[model samples]
Target: MLPIFLKTLPFFAIIALGWFAARIRFFPPVATEWLTKFVFYFALSAMLFRFSAALDLTSLWDPAFVMAYLGGSLTVWLIGMAVARARGLSLPEMAMEAHCCVIGNTGFLGVPMLVVLLGPQAVGPVLMVLIVDLLVFSTLITLIISGSGRGPIGWRTVAPLLKGLVGNPMIISMAAGLVWAWLRLPLPDPLVEFLDLLGAAATPGALFAIGASLVARSASRIGPAIWLSFAKLTLHPLAVGIAAFGIFGVQPFAAGVMVAAAALPVAGNVYILAQHFNVAMQRVSTTILISTAASIVTIPFVIHWITGGLP
Candidate 1:
């Protein structure tokens, strides 16, 4: 237990630094966006790229666990969407809220954090979730929210799907990294070292951006945003846990990843989707910020209790 906190503290500490910077208005709202963009497209992606480079496919392709994990997330998204519709929200807003609930911050947060807690091997399972998070879950959310097909599959519909793919730097990084790793091509020393330099900046840079984003005003309602946060940090992990152990019989390392998946704060892409589609960006953005800050504490406690003593 002590070790868990010891390891988790540094991760959260960097985020705290970011939160402090945000509070100080170091560069104002616009600068926050720039910082976040830098972290997303360059720093964070470089680390993930390296993580994937070291992944061994045989271990990562656990069909039973991957299918169950992906399947569970899909179910959660469906139910969440249904509920959002029942609330009579607009499709774009529904996408925003629903995405907040279902998608966790698996990329920027998930990769580096898992690397710290579970070592290089953890990259394997995180990779599995990243695939589903980017390729499948993101696509599904955009298809539903951006277009209704009530009249026709206009450019409106196609555009959202394309945007879901290309606009997300994390997803693009994952795809490119996977292809390179699969091909087993050697990365030149200078290039790998350059990536390493960028990779090293990933964790702290992302945490800071998340903190800064939280400080800026996003147009979101208090009630809905709080509810979204509660759902993401608490209930989402429970759903994943139950399914992993009860339905899939996921054990040990694989099951640990289910916890990580469940524990991720919220996908950074949620805000982008929200902004593009005119959803509650303030609420969405803040929820991501707050939940991510909260997760620094929440994740370790959950793992300490549920990890079944994985020293």
Candidate 2:
């Protein structure tokens, strides 16, 4: 247990450093934004593309694993929506709130954390979770939020969704890599080296940006954000654990990885999406901060449980 915790320490420690830097205004305010953009567009996509390219195409397909993950997340999202409705949140706000409940920082946090905790093999499963969270759950939220706006939800709403999906570098890279893998195309030495450099930066850079984002003003209403954080850090993983180990009967190691991925902090993308839709921005942003900071404690226990730690 101590060994697992020690191994996981550096990732969160880097995040804390980023938070401290931001709080101190160590770098220009806008620098973190540029770092985030570089991560989303360049480093993260490059890592995904390179991993997918090298992986066996057969290893990338795991329908049962994917479904189990989505099932747990959808359940949590629905619960969030219900809670939002009880609180009299508007439709778009409810949608965004529900999204914040489920779509975690799987790409930036889960991928690197799991890679450190588990190994390189964790990449495929983590990437699969990323794809589903972005494509399926995010698309669903967009449609709901669009419908909640003044205008009717029509082909116009879907056009932007399609456009955004097409323009997303991560999706594009994943597609290209899958195609390369299918064809068994070999990457040139120089290209592989370049990608390796980019991939190496993805983890630390992302953690830094996440910490900086936390320095901004968060939602004032701490109560709801706390509950949402609880749901994200606790309930979400419990649901995933049941689905993976009981329902799906996955192998022990794979199931453990699935639960750990599910246990990751709420995604930074939630705040981006909330800001874009202009709904529940403060609340969702605060949720990200709380869930992330809390994960430093919660995640260690989760890893120990998954690994069968003894007293």
Candidate 3:
């Protein structure tokens, strides 16, 4: 247990450093935006592209794996919605807070942590989580948030979503990589090296950006924030475990991958979505901050269990 905790400490340390740097204004204020842009536009995309491009087509098409993750995510989201509505939240507030329960920081945090803990094999399931989030959870949350009180849903409501999905760098990179993998295309050595270099920087850069984002944000409404964090850190992974181990009977490693990915903190995208729709910014930011800080303790234990530490 001590060893596992020590191993996971550095990931949190990188984030802590970022938070401290932001608090001190170590880099220019604009540097945060630039780092985010680089991770979103370049490093993350490159990392996904390289992994997806090389992924086995069979691995990409796992129905059992998909069912385990997507089903678990939907189940948790519905539960969150029920709790939010019971709390007397407005429709938009319910949507925004519920969104945090389902979607997670998969790209930046999940991918890097899983890759470090489980290595390259982790990417396939993580990619599946990303697809489900972008295609299903993200789209559904958008409709709920944007469509609320505005009128019946229509093309106008969905058009922006489609456009954003189409233009999303991570989605585009993954799709291209899938196509390339399907075609069994070979990349030139120079391009491969270039992508490798960018991919190498993605994990640390992303962790740092997350830490920095937390520095300015305060965890408001602590009770609700902690509940939402529990929904994410505990319930989400529990659902995935049931689906993967009991229902899907996925292999241990793959099951572990799905569980760990599900255990990730609320996504930074939740903040972006809240800001875009102008709702629940404080709650969303607080959730991100608290859940991320808590995961440092929770994840190592979760990983240890999945790796046979738990009886």
Going through the candidates in the order shown, the clash numbers are 4, 1, 0
Off by over 4 Å in 1: 154-156, 217-220
Question: Per-residue alpha-carbon lDDT of model 2 for 1-311, expressed as tens digits?
Answer: 78778878899899999999999999556989999999889998888899889888786787778878888888888999999999998899888878877877888888777877777877787778888887999899989988775587889889999999999888998889989999999999999999989988999999999888889847676898898889888888899888877887765666688788888888888888888888888888888888998898889989889777312
Report lDDT per candidate: 0.75, 0.85, 0.88
lDDT of 3 by residue, 201-293 (tens): 898999999888887678688888898999999999999899989998877778888898888889988899899988988888889989998
RMSD of 2: 1.9
Which pairs of residues clash in candidate 3, taking residues 3 or more apart in a chain or in different chains? none
Q: Candidate 2: lDDT of 190? A: 97
* For every candidate, C-alpha RMSD to the true structure in Å: 2.5, 1.9, 1.5
lDDT ranking, best first: 3, 2, 1
Per-residue lDDT value at 208 in model 3: 93
lDDT score at residue 98, model 1, on the 0-100 scale: 71
User: What TM-score fits each model?
Assistant: 0.88, 0.95, 0.97
Candidate 2: segments with Cα more than 4 A from true spot: 149-152, 309-311
TM-score of 1: 0.88
Q: Give the candidate order by descending TM-score.
A: 3, 2, 1
* Model 1 worst lDDT window (10 residues): 211-220
